[model samples]
Target chain A: MSLLVVGSVAFDDLETPFGRRERALGGSATYFSLSASRFHPVRIVAVVGEDFGPDQMRVFEGRPIDLAGLSKVKGLSFHWKGAYGYDLNEAKTLATDLNVFADFKPDLPANYRECDYLFLGNIDPVLQLDVVRQMARRPKWIALDTMNYWIRGSRPALDAVLKEVDILLVNDAEVRELTQEYSLIKAYKKVRALGPSTLVVKRGEYGVALFTPDGIFAAPAYPLENVFDPTGAGDTFAGGFLGYLAWIERTDVTALKHATLVGSVMASFTVEQFSTERLEQISQDEVRNRLALFSDMIRVEDL
Target chain B: MSLLVVGSVAFDDLETPFGRRERALGGSATYFSLSASRFHPVRIVAVVGEDFGPDQMRVFEGRPIDLAGLSKVKGLSFHWKGAYGYDLNEAKTLATDLNVFADFKPDLPANYRECDYLFLGNIDPVLQLDVVRQMARRPKWIALDTMNYWIRGSRPALDAVLKEVDILLVNDAEVRELTQEYSLIKAYKKVRALGPSTLVVKRGEYGVALFTPDGIFAAPAYPLENVFDPTGAGDTFAGGFLGYLAWIERTDVTALKHATLVGSVMASFTVEQFSTERLEQISQDEVRNRLALFSDMIRVEDL
Candidate 1:
């Protein structure tokens, strides 16, 4: 099963306690594609800028990624500047320049219209709906990620896309904001009522939790001694999660549980470095080893 | 195996989003002894004032709790007035009248000294050390709990108590404050170097995590739609955790892992209502059922 991700391919200026990087190859789609490509082929429908050259493209090279729909436009790409204090869980956004992304319109290629898995990253809910409409056939799974901005500003549009999504990936704050409910269980119930059957509440350092009608499953963040940067961890988590599901070709609870762990394992690596540096260079063996360790860490045997 | 807990046992006036209770039976040792007594016999050593009458004592009735060390002084019992908002994770302390607790001197009974397992609740480290010293022979396992007050004010006393502890259970903030390490892994390591081989970081709502030289184990809080009050959750967790260890009579990593989940299960019930109301009325069947459910929720089958 093929995976299609529609998001941004841009640059980031990151500063953390460990180190700093400028003009880092980033963006939701870039991280997602790199991470998902590790397990399955990913078709990315996102726009980059003219500044994105061969060096930047090399990050996706040798990976099972389709870039036909990744348009290289005339202007600069989406650039974000953020700084993290001692608390890596929250980032303080210094600036966000939605250059080419402001007037951006996702134009999926013919082959991408039939992707089995579709992930609409954090974007305008109206644009996300447009991407969904462009799909020739409904993908096997549609996962959408939204932020507080969209949830608060353009709720009607956001609700429209959410109705068509099977899984909704957003941070814990976003879930609370969207539902206006403090209790996570109640918030999840309200979210499921809106449409997406499963809600993945990503709690940065605390870890990620899955809320579904069947029950809830939670995985703690891989205890890391050094977190260099946390820029694209959420997107990387989605990529790895959807990628694993596509690889196994299963969306059942058991598979979703395992995929959630896989997603956590992938996100663990992303925070070790800035942007997609670690994700681009990670090997399958590394992922498998971490998955085994993580499974051991969280698994509780029968009494 | 016998378990002995030494901490404050008194009254509480609590206000939460759900409701309020005035002069409820509460305290660290009260919650810990009740939660632990479900699995094993518990001997409690703490001071309550004359106001703690038969009704207060009845909270521990029909349970395997020894009140031989429960001293009834002339003055008022320790009373705490607190409130919780929508975010139940943090509580606002409106008032804390130590009363008799201020001069609490834990006088362990002869039989209590030989208990196989011991838990020193968040009390004066000096008093905790005194309790440790009162033991005829060292227990099979000794766990200690502390707070930022002691960490910041009584470093020497805390360090002294830590040296004699086999396990240290404290919340995440306390861990960071005690070790001055931002990374939890590092903080756990630093804590291990101090004394206790096991560091149980009790993350209130996010859940609890165990950090040892061997590895780390994390358990998410049970998904609850209604959390009436989160007053004694951590104490309840410690009780359930050490109680399970005593029940199985094993201190291995596997036993610790299972115990951690059991602790989470016990704490889940504690927050369902205020004070010890839920803990006192909960049946073993309910605990076992939830433990089974929790085990199933966290268990990851082999790929």
Candidate 2:
């Protein structure tokens, strides 16, 4: 199954307890594509700037990723500056330079119009809806990710796109904020009322919780001794989740549960270093071994 | 196997988002005994006051619990006034009047001294150590629970008791505070050096994580729509954990993992209502059913 993601492609300045990186390859689509590519082909529909060079292109070299929809504009790329303390769960954004991204318009290539799986990354809700409308036909499954910014500032636009989404992914706080409900089950109910039948609530270090009509499944994050950076953990998690579903080509409870675990396993690797450094270097065998380890960590059996 | 616990027994005035309870029976030992007695015979060694009446005693009636060591002092019983907001994770303490508890001393009964399993609930570290010393012989297993006050105020005493404890259970925050480490894995390592071979980090709402010589096992809390009060959840979790171990009489990783789920099941019921109301009325069948449900929530298997 073909997967398409529409979001930001940016350069980031990150400072963490472990180290620092300037102008590192980042963005929602970047992390999502790299993570999803490990499972299936990922087609990126995001705009980059002239500053995105061969070195950055090499990061995706030899990978099954299509960049036909990656538009290169004249202005600088989307750039962000963030820092993290000992508590790696939250990041403090110091600066966000949307330069070319501020006036961005996602125009998917003809080849990407019929992707079986679609992931609308965190962008303006209006833009997200526009991408869905431009799809040659509705994808088999459409998962959308939004943030507090759109949830508060563009409720109608967000709701408009949410109606077209089959799956929704948001962090724990965003879900509560979006629904104005502290209880996750209640928030999930409200989300289901809006549109998406499946909601994956991402709890950075705590793990991820999946809520569907069948029931709820909660997966714990892999216990790590050190978390170098947490910049794109959420997007990487979304990629892994949707990517696994695309590869397996199923949406049943069992498949969703496995996807939830696979997402945790992918995000666990993302936080091990700045940007997609760890994601770019991890082997499939390592991912499977960690998934097995996580299974043991959460498994319960009778004597 | 007989289990013995030495901690406070108090009367609580509570206010939560759902409702309120005045002069409700509440305390570490009270919740612990009520939860543990459901699985095995529990012996409580703690001090009360003249105000303690037959109605208060009825909370423990017909349960497999020994109250012979419940001392009635001259002063009033320990009283606590607390409130909770929509975020049921933390409580706001308005007042705490430790009248009789201030001058309390744990005096174990003859029969209680040789209990095969012993639990030292949250109390003065000195008193916990004294109870450990008074045992006729070392119990088959010894578990201890402590809090921030003792961790910050009585380091030497707490350290002395930690040397003799086979298992230690404390909330996530307390574990980090005790070792001054922000990372849970690092904190668990520091705790291992302190002498307790097994450390159970009780994360309310999020779930429980057990760290032992073998490895780690994490369990997710049962997702609930209504959480009335969360006052004694940690103590109740401890009671369920030690009680299950006492019932099975095993400390293997599998047993410990099952025990972790049982503890979560017990704690889930404790928060359904204020004080011991829910714990008192729950049937063993309900507990087992919830345990099975929890296993289904966390269990991961291949498709």
Report clash pairs, candidate 2. none
**Quality of model 1 by C-alpha lDDT:** 0.91
lDDT by residue (tens digit), candidate 2, A215-241: 899977889887899999989999998
Candidate 1, superposed: residue stretches over 4 Å from native? none
> Model 2 off-target regions past 4 Å?
none
Kindly give the stretch of ten consecutive residues in candidate 1 chain B with the minimal lDDT sum. B294-303
- DockQ per model, Cα: 0.75, 0.68
Residue B60 lDDT in model 2?
92
- List model 2 lDDT by residue over B33-66, tens digit each: 9999888899999899999999999999999989
Looking at model 1, residue B175 earns an lDDT score of 91
